[model samples]
Target: MSHTEQAMPRRAGQQGLWVLVAVAVSLALLAGCGDDGPTDLQPDAGTEPEVCGPSDVWCKDQTIDRLDLLTTVSTGEVREEGTTSGEFLTFVDSRAGGLSPTMSYSYLRFTPQGLTPVQIHDQESLGSTDWDLAVRRYTLRVNSGTSGPSCVSVANTPEGTTFASVTAVNAAMEFKTEAWFDTACTLIPDDSGLNGPLTQLGGFWAYTSCVQMTGRVFVIRLADGRHVKLEVTSYYEPSAQQVCNQTGSVPQPSGSGAIRIKWAFLP
Candidate 1:
């Protein structure tokens, strides 16, 4: 749907109601004023209702399920064989180019077996269901919202929870879509690392002039309802000689956008 025409019934709240009430009161007063006044207070018979303002618009359409669009591909062999039952795979060079405004995002698809890189980039990714998550530097976007058409969303795990501890998806867990704007259509700041808004899955890391992983684990609920627990392992390249402190402050930072994540499909 067009951004302006999005079905945002939630925005038609007390303000809209009050507008109607005020109009009714004005019409009633006009009716009592004189019989000479022309009667049709409403719009002409064939005329459309007033259009809602930009702030009144919202998007609630159900996302396209990517499971139906899965193309057969060779899955990457499970790597790291970590402490948990889940697989740990690191995606190097998620930072496509330097932070140019025109730089394209690196896209990847998550499957039950492993992660695969998606070739298509730019606006075309929004229409394709082949990809689940798109990364550019530290910022991330799922297949939903202004990002794409699929219904991928995420639920953040509680504090101090290990990846192995989160085995099943909680029925009551709150899932968040890729929301970039406030109710007033303002862009929420990414603050720490980038110029964009902080997305649902992008909360994995925090900034303090230098970037650091928040150690937050998230349960990603794919478009088809399967859950995968994910943790961002590192933002710096493991091979780099200069290591930053626990606070993620380094004198000459290299490998700023190189990202590695640990994830496993939950039962």
Candidate 2:
């Protein structure tokens, strides 16, 4: 029989098998060579706490804690005024241990959470006392309604005045105008009598001459660009003991009045 016409029965089933294998290899190579580009990933949302904004309802509704700054000056001491620290918050007795009005001023470091003391420069190099060398970190303003000086009202409420900075507060004081809404902003008087809702350093006294820090909200700004809204909840100890004596003398050590404050970090 001629070779061209000869039957090759074993090769019939596997006919075109090489071509099929080549096509399968080509497909596999194409898949392997596909563009495996970088994926666009995103960060997880809501990982951080939402900061309270100025107009947020939470700002008005949040409970204000009573922070006490005690009479004694030291670091990490929890008094009625708030936490006491020579670095973050300091009540500088210009009288060198005397707590007289105008004779005493305070330097507070305005952080997001609370107040701190201004940094003290080296006294030996400058030849000035620490109190003299210390700078004013922030200013405090007294917010009373247009009716003026209601110590009994709830502080920083929707009905009450809002917070104001030191400059605006001083302007309000100078112009005798309102700091928030129609609420009048009173300049803290230098008198030791604790009269007229005057903005004294550390805390303010009520019309009754008691260190009741209700309805007193202060808008304070720091040099480092922090603004805070704070209220004096109490200027007395938990036992209803006053922080400062009406006679302008320091309270007895046992009965010493501490500064109690309720504050919020503002945007």
Candidate 3:
């Protein structure tokens, strides 16, 4: 072998050492993004499902787990009012849609069987609408009705993951979201964080509580990485007073707090 080839063995050996080191670092990833194990359920981010049958809402080649409470996010703040102000979130791509679009990917987490909380502007867990949307699209419905909202179903998209939507009736169904092979999302192989362009991939997966909407189309967007466009109406932010007016759905409508989490992959 040439001189360069002769020296390759040492370099390769060093890389092997690095791989081992990385494997033994801290097992941080083994834990969820927030903490890395099961802590206390205080509504950090938080139900289900119906219409096309809750069990039917899933990706064939992907797996996921999620939960949602029939809750609301009503911060007293004027800017964020009845929106994901300081409380919880409960909608998907109510932006623009058809009626029966296929989904892409998604994942969701929830308390065993009770109402949970959602922390707005939850910076610690890389929380944000876009990030939340990403996870929601990949995990749950575009417009879920764990509370009372209606019109939920998946939409048709060009290609990729679009959170399936379903109606809200009085059904308390257990559900999950999933995805399959997607190459378009390749640009963003590691979107759990700020890895690369939020693109769609041929392969995807997710799980969530429930989805509620009435669109029959979907759009796989390449903007800000991989985002699925559900065929539904726009997400309308409710007024603080309006949200507060509706009681029993959740306890506190307008409140702000930080979110801490610890999770592990469910079998």
Every model's TM-score: 0.64, 0.34, 0.18
Cα lDDT over the full model 3: 0.27
Q: How far does residue 194 in candidate 2 sit from its true spot (Å)?
A: 4.4
Q: Ranking by lDDT, best first?
A: 1, 2, 3
In model 1, which range of ten residues has the least summed lDDT?
62-71
Q: Report the lDDT of model 1 for residue 263.
A: 86
Candidate 2, residue 10: lDDT: 40
In Å, residue 132's CA in model 1 sits off its true spot by 0.6
lDDT of 2 by residue, 38-147 (tens): 33343334443333211211111111111111233323233223463311222322221224222112433344434444332211112111111121111133212221
Top candidate, metric TM-score: 1
**Which segments of candidate 3 are over 4 A away from where they belong?**
1-115, 126-233, 237-267
The parts of candidate 2 lying over 4 Å away from their true place are: 1-106, 119-204, 241-254
Write down the TM-score for model 1. Answer: 0.64
Give the per-residue lDDT of model 3 (tens digit) for 1-267.
899999999999999999988987756565445654455643454222223322232221121212222122323121111232222223333111112222322222232221122343212112122212223222223222220111232223333323333222112332222222243322223334423222222123211111112223333221122222323221122332233234312234322111111111111
> What does the lDDT come to for candidate 1?
0.64
Task: Name every residue pair that clashes in candidate 1.
Answer: none
Residue 84 lDDT, candidate 2, scale 0-100: 34
